[model samples]
Target: MTETLRASAPPVATGAGAIAVLRDLASYVDARAEAFSARSSWLVAAATHLAGEPVVVVAHEDGQVVGLAALSVTRHRGTARVTLLGGELNDYGQLHHDGPRAARALAGALVDWLRAQRRWSLDLTQLAPEDPALAALVRLLPGAVVSPGAPMPRIEGVGTSYRVKRDRRRKATGAFNAAGRDGLRAEKLVLDDLAGLERWLPALVEVRRARDHASGRRSQLDDPGVLAFHTSVVRGAVAAGAGVVHVMLVEDEVAGFVTVLVDGDTHRLYDGRVAERWLAYRGGTVCDIEAVLRAQDDPGVHTFDWLRGWTEAKFGNAEVVRAGLHASSHPSVDRLDRWEATARRRLKAALPDAAVRRIVSR
Candidate 1:
């Protein structure tokens, strides 16, 4: 039996209409067990609003929305390009589909639609290597390019007792003690602290800026759009009970802060920053350890995800490698995207820490 599938780009509206679509799509994705950050209606709406355009592509199977490919269109160097809706903010780009057959049909249809629109390219980076939709798209689009994505570090067993290396554990504990001796107190930001969140956000941006300047690098928060988007999303997430912020203060002055996103049993560290003046006290490390402890204590959290990158801090925990995908009707564009991705990996490998940070911050 042949399954009928059709794809269409729907105009996304705000308010009640948007919520209705999100509710329906979220329900469908949850039923298929293909839920992820990008697939969430909240995130989709936020991404669309931040992008200031509507580019949601829906795949309907027998008159029901079974899959979607949300994208944001932007002009780069005189050429329009389309990227996953949340862009770099999303750790993983999802193509929410009912199953393999539906995924294949959606992939083919999406490709045809994209070609007809004549976009320069479509980039979906930092996808899990084993993502079903990625495999389907690659299989259907012969010109698609595959590349390695930054490896995201994660700490599993959040709700259980997890073991850490003895030396690292000792160091983390020592940092916590040092902070305590310095009269630094840690607290989790709650819904009631919306005002505090507003205050601390700009402080975090400043701290990040100072740290990056000292290290001779740029900060992503330097971009007005990125900063605005983060501020809006974090505010919305907190209101929706989907996010939390942890803060460490010294004499009532903000010293460090960490923002995390909650999705069911998992918590992802979205961003973190520490005042440069507090580095000697290791405020950042202390804040991180406290955040981990809180996650372990919370009955709702079962895993702590450091998100898409490996660092020394994540060494004692488990890690996962994600991949990136690029596809275009033009073979040359596909090759170029692949080459650029490979070059980025190589550059990151060869550059000094400060130089690499500068490159990535942009």
Candidate 2:
């Protein structure tokens, strides 16, 4: 007999009860090596709390949880929009499923359920281009608008060595030399540095705030919730052996920091910050090159992901593209989203490279 799979957004009690369920579901589906962000219980827990009125949809087969999707429901101008949880913090938003068959089933059930809801429109954003759920949604809802999100640049085949281009390598070497001359040294932060992380977190926030201010842009670190979420994630991920933090110090003073998530053979550069004053010493570039070199030395690491964005300085040697995905149920919303996307592309194309970078980096 074929396994019967059913998807439902079961009501969950607020606070502790919801957290437990989210953790359980994350652990259940996180067994796969490629689960990355989806498998992070701490991230899920943070997202659930951060997303106002969270709705968790799970697919059950033979009474076992086989797939799950977390969403945030918010009303805007009498129209309710359901978005993937975690907001801008999430690099990719996709359903966690056991297999392709289960994925299709889960997607169908989810679309059907969303359709039956009141004043609701589905908005799936920042999904991987090849995410099964994206294809499933397109097939299920022909009227849904699909658009491109930011580009994800990654360096493949990092197990034995890195594949930096000649010019980029020379530039990195120059930065490293400059950093050494400036008395800057790079070091990895270990589990014992949990307390040290507490001190460093604020410094990183300050660095980011300073940089953003200099560029006339708003920093997400200004938000207490984003700050708290990252603090929770870094602590939890480091304790779980799923992440590491690398820092550049100049004679006991922190100059820059980078956080990375390790998943099987892949090392994802999640976030980083460099003090504005240290820019002249090329502290940020030096720290990043050091981190990449360390990842290359790790026998278990085969790929280094720069995450979302396309920057020549950092991702000039990117071997693969991890495109983001988006879809909307409302026709007007879909058209508007597409228009915005098109406008962004056109503007990017018309502006100078440096101006484009400033616009996107803001």
Score every model by TM-score: 0.78, 0.79
**Per-candidate clashes, comma-separated:** 1, 0
On residues 28-86, what C-alpha lDDT tens digit does candidate 2 reach at each position? 55664243555646446556446455666666676766667766667655556777667
lDDT of 1 by residue, 1-362 (tens): 11222223243333344444555465454454422456565455455455534355666666656677666667654345777667777776676677777677667767766666664677887766776778888887767788987777777886575634467657866765676676766443432256757776777778777777667566666767667767777877776777778777665555677788777788878778777777766666766776777787887777888887776666436777778887666666656667989997897678887776656456
Per-residue error at 82 for model 1, in Å? 2.0
Which ten contiguous residues of candidate 2 have the minimum total lDDT? 1-10
Q: What is the C-alpha lDDT of each candidate?
A: 0.66, 0.65
lDDT of 2 at 319: 45
Candidate 1's error at 89, in angstroms? Answer: 1.3
Look at candidate 2 and tell me the lDDT of residue 135: 82
Candidate topping TM-score: 2
Q: Candidate 2 local accuracy as lDDT? A: 0.65
RMSD each, Å: 5.4, 5.4
**Model 1 TM:** 0.78
